[model samples]
Structure formats: C-alpha cells, structure tokens
Target: MQVQVKLFAFFREGRFIKEDKELPTDTTAGQVIDDLNIDREEVGVLMLNSRHCKFDTVLQEGDIYAIFPVIGGG
Candidate 1:
C-alpha cells in the first residue's frame, strides 16, 4: 500500500518535506518513525488524514500521515 508522508519542522532535516511512501498493510505510525531513524521522544504530534493520532495508529492505503517534532518557546 502507498501512503503520503509529511514531515514538519526539524523533522525534515536531512529528509523530505513530503513524499508518497510504499508501506506494508497495517503499518503503525511508530514503525514509520522508527524506519526513518526518528526518536519517538522527539515526536510532538502525529496526524492521520488531518486528525490527531497516536504512534500506534494503523496506517491505511492512500492515507496522509504527518509528523511534527517537539517545539519549544516561551
């Protein structure tokens, strides 16, 4: 199955801003992060199809997934 992945903020460093990725069925958001060598602790948000989701959220074919890194400000 294919899914659209969008990386935000520092998450796009050395990576792509957005791209269509070929993934296995039932792949979890966490799995994709792991595959990209992203640290779970650094992940600030996960969105599936524009809705807030978790790392364990299962990704479906043609789904749009977005990842954001923790942002700090005062």
Candidate 2:
C-alpha cells in the first residue's frame, strides 16, 4: 500500500522529507510514525482526510495524511 507521509516542525529538519511509505494492508497510523524514528512528543496532531485522528487509526491507501509538530504558546 502506498501511504503519504509528512513531517513538520523540527522533524522536517531531521531525517525527514517528502516521501511515500509502504506498509501492509492493516497498518496503523502509529506504526508508520514510529518507522520514521520521530519523537512522539514532537508531533502535535495527526490528520487523515482533514479529520484529526489518533495514532492507532488504521491508514487507508491514497489518503493524504499530515503530521504536524506541537505548537506552544507562552
């Protein structure tokens, strides 16, 4: 399956860039994230089809998933 993976904030500065990930049919959102070796706290949100979902959410092929970093305000 072809899933689009995105990285934001400092993650983008690390070992991440625009790329496509391949996984089994039952792959969860969390698995893909972990494969990137990204720090969990660094991610603020996970959106699939514009709706926010948890990492356990099962990823569907051809879905436009966006992972953004946590934004903090003083």
Candidate 3:
C-alpha cells in the first residue's frame, strides 16, 4: 500500500516535508514513525486522512498521514 506522509516543525529538519511512501499491509502509524527515525516522545500529534489517530492506528492504502512534533514555548 502507498500512503502520503507529512512532517511538521522540527520533524522536517534534515528530512522531507512530505512524501509518498510504500508500506506493507497492516502497517501502523508507529511503524511509519519508526521508519522515519522519529522518537515516539517527539511526536505530538498523529492524523490520518485529516482525523486524529493513535500511534497504533492501522494505516490504509492511499491514506494521508501527518505527524506533528511536540512544541514548546513560554
């Protein structure tokens, strides 16, 4: 299956802002994060097809997944 992935904030540094990735069936959001070498602690939000989703959420073909990093400010 092929899915679109979007990275936000620092997550995009030294990495692509967005890309289409080919994954195996039954792949999870957490698996994508792992493939990107992103720490689970750094992930603030996970969205699938514009809806909030959990790290364990199973991804589907042609799904759009966006990952936002934890933000810190005063």
Candidate 4:
C-alpha cells in the first residue's frame, strides 16, 4: 500500500516536508513515526486524510497522513 506523509514544523528539518511512502497492509501511524525516527512524545497532532487520528490508527492505501510536532511558547 502507498501513502503520502506530510511533516510539519521542526519535523521537516533534515528531512522532507512531504513524500510518498510504500507501507505494508495494516500499518499503524505509530509504525510510520518509528520508521521515520520521530519521537512519539514530540508529535502534537496526527491527521489522516485531513481528520485527526491517534497513533494506533490503521493506515489505508492512498491515505494522506500528516504529522505535526508539539509547539511550546510563552
């Protein structure tokens, strides 16, 4: 299955902002994060096809997944 991944904020540093990825069936959002070497604690939001989703959410083929890092400011 193929899915598009979009990284936001500091997540894009030293990496791409968006790219197509081929994953196995029944792959979860958390797996992708791990494959990308992103810390789960740093993730602020996970979106699948424009809707908010959890890390355990199962990804589908052709789905658009976006990951945003947590932002902190005073």
Query: Model 2 scores what on Cα lDDT?
Result: 0.81
Candidate 3 per-residue lDDT over residues 19-66, each given as its tens digit: 999999999999999989999998998999999999999999999999
- Candidate 1 wrongly placed segments (more than 4 Å): 72-74
Whole-model lDDT values for every prediction = 0.95, 0.81, 0.95, 0.96
Error of 4 at 43 (Å): 0.4
**What does candidate 4's lDDT look like per residue over 12-63, in tens digits?**
9998999999999999999999999999999999999999999999999999
Clashes of each: 0, 0, 0, 0
- In terms of lDDT, the poorest run of 10 residues in model 1 is 65-74
Q: Which portions of model 2 show Cα errors greater than 4 Å?
A: 72-74
In candidate 1, residue 42 scores what lDDT? 94
In order, what is each prediction's RMSD in angstroms?
Answer: 1.4, 2.0, 1.7, 1.8
For lDDT, the strongest prediction is: 4
Model 3 stretches astray by more than 4 angstroms: 72-74
Residue 34 miss distance in model 1 (angstroms): 0.2
The local lDDT score (0 to 100) that residue 26 gets in candidate 4 is: 99
Candidate 2 on 1-74: residue-level lDDT in tens? 88888776777886676678777988888887787787777779988878998889999888777788887779
Looking at candidate 2, the ten consecutive residues that score lowest on lDDT are 14-23
